[model samples]
Target: MDKIIIIDFGGQYTHLIGRKVREKGVYSEIVPYDMKIEEIDSNVKGIILSGGPYHVSEDSPKIDPRILDLGIPILGICYGHQLIAYMSGGKVGPSKKKEYGITYVNIINNNDILKGLSKKEKVWMSHSDSVFSLPDDYEVLAYSENCPIAAFKHKYKPIYGVQWHPEVYHTENGDVIFENFISICNCNRDWKIENLLDKMIEEVRNEVKNGKAIIALSGGIDSSTAAMIAAKAIGNRLVAVFVDHGFMREGEVESIKNTFKELNLIVIEAKDRFLEKIKGVSDPELKRKLIGEEFIRVFEEIAEKVGAEYLIQGTIYPDRIESGLRHSDKIKSHHNVAGIPSKIKFKKIIEPLRDLYKDEVRKIALKLGLPKEIVYRQPFPGPGLAVRIIGEVTKEKLEIIRKADKIVREEIEKSKIREKLWQYFAVLTDTKTTGVKGDERAYGYVVAIRCVESREAMTARFANIPYKLLERISTRITNEIPQVVRVVYDITHKPPATIEWE
Candidate 1:
């Protein structure tokens, strides 16, 4: 397969770049920044240098200087862009004014890579350094207000570099630029996630074999899909365990059990125990670590009872990425990945969907013919409402947030806009606000509503809900949930605020 090789330099969106390439029907493989030059084969049509949190100095990461001599088409992003310029004798320095998000640039040249894009392009940027002077044989292609050299290209070589990230959704005409690059690489569209179903199932069978396995089925799309795939591989040998840690939304456990009744579903009632464990933990990361460790201990107990030797989880790519990879910084600790303690009892753990993002997992879910409710279900954090309730984990706050989240879902569904949404829920904040109800002064917890639209869990933008709908939701939340004296909607995107407030 002709593939695009992305050299990861610990950028949070490194995997997102690969997912976008694969989204365009071309295979993309991510390798370390120090991957040997010889390891890159002729099948690799092009190379993309991913952005990272580097300032590009003596301590910055590097690729083989021979990479430029390989004559392969190269596209460098943020740090990659600076590296290309600095290596080839261009001057780079810290920016007097940094470009963080939603910046506009004017094109100076109509490069083939920027074809189909307008003269002025809106892009996402998070860079602290700027290329001050161009290298020999390199010319500026675009410039922004703060930086003179926002983009550049080789004079005689098919090499391009951009100071902004094109892989993110915030960039305008990102698809067009990717298509133009695909054309420049002279590649064909041959990659598809749906084509790998059989192979994935076979791998699951090989990993478990005859050993009984317990799956941490959270009833979300990721775990539900994994459960279906694993069940097909090992049949009744797969036990789907749904833990009701007393943090789930109202009636969620019953809805899940009824959905997967055909499978050997076991519901563990440990709500009180989880609340007790998470009590007084104010830090979100600490709460995740505690909940994650408790979940493992619960699974270990079940594993011992069933005599199972392996544990299966619905962990996906975003979960792993946010939890922090060795090369990348930790955004937050996912209960499944970073939250897992160092102690375990299972012989091995299996995550069938670890490599896939949410959208890709949903594609496989449809291929496996999972129920629509399960396939299109909104994403839920493994730590549940514990992450939604800020500051402390209390039964009262959980009840307020649970009812508010339920109201959010009901209103979105009632408005017939559920299908267009990725995930919609309510967050109970620690701060209390003053309100007047029936001429009575009341002070109570503030509830926040978060509804975002995103392809994968990596990047998200706030949904533009109708005003009447917002009015209706706010009215209902305050009216129904007396503890919520005030209701406010979250207008911030993912970079500024995550889906869950924690």
Candidate 2:
């Protein structure tokens, strides 16, 4: 059972490297940076050093250099590249000018892993430090305009280093690079979704035992997949709780209901007096906290009614990191953690998908025979339209946003662009602009349409939407939603901006 070990150095795409290895039918696992290098023996055929936020010359944490001495095929990425250079008698320094986005790399030759790749290719680069010098035993493989040593390989060892991320979608031919590494290492092709399903079923059954399991069903891919898996493992003992917080899309409630009905699982539909409580809230964090606290209250009451002992929510890896729980800085508030009240009462909490990322969850969903629509649905935040809208939430605002979002969906579907995008919708803002409605001066809200294409929601780029399609959406939104006087499109990517407006 040959496998590849990925050492996590805190870069956002560390797990993505492991995913790429797994996609090539190879088994991979993320190990802590402090893990012993001697553990990489016998069955371990390859090693991948992941990128991180820390600079190599900084007085921060460092990994054991014995990892390079393990004598296996090693590939260092980004910070991994810097770590190898700094620890192996080389020099590293801050980049004179940071290469934060897309850049072109020139492959020096057609040898080693760069064999089939083109002489010139676009790769994503994000670093504040660069390797100033390479060791005497190493040879340069590729270089960019700014960073001279973009790729390198040692002469006597099977070790390689890449200054850019090969796992990111922005990098061209990234997957093929991993495939070559896996093939060259002769790693086993045993990691498949079917195998994972059997393992998860057994694990869930043992964890739940005879106790009941309660899953918070939000009609999204994460929770819906969690609910389905738990139901299969525990039968009727799995209780599904759906909370309607008055911020969902137009058809979310009925869509969730239909899903559970098809599965024939026991569902407890809980609807709060959403309009009464969140009618005029403005602050983003405050809005999340209020919704979270209110949701816990509803869950407590529903748990009492159903007599369940465990409260399960779909807490993904990114959600935990974004909530500042994992090895990541605080990015945003996940409703399950940031929004839920601290004083929780009744039933222990369980999260099956907590350790898995968004892409992994989709694989699990596909393995479990979930519908295509449900499996590929865009990642929607638990706060729903409440967070997407830029101001205080109200019935009128919700209605206007819902209709505008519906128009976006309809036009996208009609134009056949829905399949090409990851997520697309409309948002209402607090500011209003004056416009002419039937030759009369009228003041109404501003709506911004967001459409993006991404493999996973971790980082995304704006979708190159057709101008004619945008025209149709803009026209329909202004004509249908009287409260909306103008429509604008968001053309920003993820690094400088997040997916949502708030």
Candidate 3:
């Protein structure tokens, strides 16, 4: 089997390269930047130098020169390009002009990797340094309008380098560029979602082996996909445990019940002990810990009755990556990942979708023929608006945010814009502005609507929502939800700020 090794340099999208490679039916793995060449097997056919937030001229920049001598095909992206130049006797220094966002590249020499792309192409570039001088052994295969060496190839070797990221959708012809690389490298595209499902079933069967499994069915994509997969694997031996936390979004409880019925899976709906657990806690982390502890307790009680020996969760790649489990940034704590109890004795944890991203999970969901309502649903935080609301988790705040979010969705649906955007939702901020209603001073929480356009959740840009749609959403939220006096639209992208405020 052909394999690729992605050397991680702490770039947020380092794992995305591995994901794309896997999607192409090639096995790939992510390793640390400082790992020596001796640690990796020589049988690996290729290496992908991932983009990172480092400058080659910076003190103590990472460089692994030994891999260059292995003669394996190498693809360098962004910072990787800079490092290659700096390490291969080329000079790298600060550029007078910074090429940050989307850049226009003029490919002078159309090489094998640029087969499907034309001479004038737009690629994603994010770097402040340029290769002042090229090494004697490398040739400048491609060049942009400003940058001389937008792409390079080592003399008499299969190593290639690109100054832009092809994994990101922002770059035009990214897919075509990847196809060229895959074809030239002879990577087999055998990793289908259906094949992954078959592999998961086999893994689950071996793990359970005539035993039973318990699942936390939260009606979300992850949980729902996990439940369906587990049921498919072990049939009636799978028992789904739904914890009605009372703080869930509208229609979630009924949604869970209806979905389970349609799937013909045994569901154990656990209600009435959730509210008692989080009585007066206001801190966000404390709230997550409380919910997680209570959830484990409920699962343990149910597992004892069902004799389940394994606990299955809808833990996706983003869940673990965001929770510091993978090569992703440390975002907020997901109840499924960071909220696990100190001592969990129910059974071994199994997650089939743990290595997949959000878009991949949606693809899997669609392949499984899940309901459109569930398949195309917006991304929801596992903590359930607790972190969305910057302050505490009061009933008043939850209701206000929920109504605001509903209005946003309704307006988008009415305007026929819901399908165009990736995710659009409302959040309740702790800031309260002064407003005059009926000649009275009103101080209440502010609601912010976030709409972003992105292919993968790794990077995103602000969505250009129409003003008419915003007007309708604002009007409905103010008229219907009295607690919220002001509604603000968030126009910030993902770099300067994250989707979630907390």
The best candidate in terms of TM-score: 1
Best by lDDT: 1
Ranking 2 against 3 by TM-score, winner: 2
TM-scores across all candidates?
0.97, 0.92, 0.87
Clashing pairs in 2: none
Tens-digit lDDT string for candidate 3 (262-342): 555454444446545666666766777777777777788888887887899898876666566544456666778788888
Candidate 2 lDDT over 1-502, as tens digits, reads 7789888887777777887887787888888888887676688899898888787865755678777787888888999988888888888888788998799999996477676889898999988888878889988889899998888888899888889988988998888679878876887788774467667677778777898767788878898888878888898888787877777788877887887775554444433475466667888878777777777787887777877777878888777756765454566787788787777874467777876777789889988888988888787888888887777877777788888888888888787777778889888888899988889998998999999987766678998899999998999888888888988899999765777777
Candidate 3 positional error at 63, Å: 7.6
Pick by lDDT: 1 or 2, better one? 1
- Listed per candidate, the RMSD to the true structure in angstroms reads 1.5, 2.5, 3.4
Model 1, position 469, has a per-residue lDDT of: 89
lDDT of 3 at 127: 77
Return the candidate ranking by lDDT, descending.
1, 2, 3
TM-score of 1: 0.97
Better of 1 and 2 by TM-score: 1
lDDT of 1: 0.88
Q: CA lDDT of each candidate?
A: 0.88, 0.81, 0.77
